[model samples]
Target: MRIGELSRQTGTSTRSLRYYEQRGLITAHRDHNGYRRYDHDVIHVVKNLRRLLGAGLSIDDIHQFGTCVRALDLDATPCASALEVYEQRLRTLDTKIDTLNHLRANLAEHTKDLRQRLRAK
Candidate 1:
């Protein structure tokens, strides 16, 4: 099918599809008329791209997924590469959470000190 058909089927913009091509997330062959033609398998790939992007995965992260990205479908199973990326992201989020909790505790103590000082005044 053509880029337009793929876009309509996946509900993704043609511009995004082009960008995905440029980023090496997908590929399309040019026809004699210079129109971009994609394979039927691309429909699933595009859907996975949108899902990964929505889940906060970067293009680089998707690239890291390699063939694993293409393997995504209705099946609830994610490939090992996908698992690695998610684990890394989880660790990063955990670090951020710990930092925020430390800051919150410090702010609470400061607020308590200010309240006690105001009462003394």
Candidate 2:
């Protein structure tokens, strides 16, 4: 199908599809008229890409394991690189949570001290 059809079918913008092509996430062939043409199976690939993006995976992270995902066989066999990406993202989130918790505790203590000072005055 053409780019417009793919975009409509995937509910993705043509610009995003172009960006995906530039990022090596998707491939398209140029017709004689210079229109971008994609295979019908690319719809599945785009859906998977959207799912990964919604999960907070960056383009680079997706690219790392996109080949396995684009294979469309993940339902039967999960990719090892995909597992690694998930693990990395989880660790990053854990670190951010820890930092935020520490900040919250510090802020609570400061607020408590300021309240006591105000009461004394």
Candidate 3:
């Protein structure tokens, strides 16, 4: 399909698709009319890329594992650094959760105080 179709299907912007191509995470062929044509398999790859991004991976991190994987003749393992990246993300998420819980408790206490003040008034 064309870039527009891929964008619509994947819920990604055309620019992001192009950026992925530039980052070596995906590829497309150029038609005679200069339009980029992507294969059906790209949908799966794009979804995986989206998952990796959602998991807090940078483009550089994805690129590190992507290029070698794309070369059909080679059978390289996935990037070992990904485990560290996932661990870091998990740690960050844990910190955020703790911070949010603390804030929620503070807010709940403030809300009770406000209720009591309103009742007194």
lDDT of 3 by residue, 1-121 (tens): 9999999998889999999999778899999999999998787678767777876777876665544334333223455555555677688889999999999999999999999999999
- Clash pairs, candidate 1, are none
* Model 3, runs deviating above 4 Å: 1-15, 22-24, 38-44, 54-78
Per-candidate TM-scores read 0.81, 0.91, 0.62
Q: Report lDDT (CA) for all predictions.
A: 0.90, 0.90, 0.78
Note each model's CA RMSD in angstroms: 2.3, 1.4, 4.6
Candidate with more favorable, higher lDDT: 1 or 3: 1
Off by over 4 Å in 2: none
Q: State the lDDT of candidate 1 residue by residue for 41-107, as single tens digits.
A: 9999999999989988889888888887786572575588888888888898899999999999999
**Residue pairs that clash (backbone atoms under 3 angstroms), model 2:** none
Q: List the residue pairs that clash in candidate 3.
A: none
List clash counts for every candidate, in order. Answer: 0, 0, 0
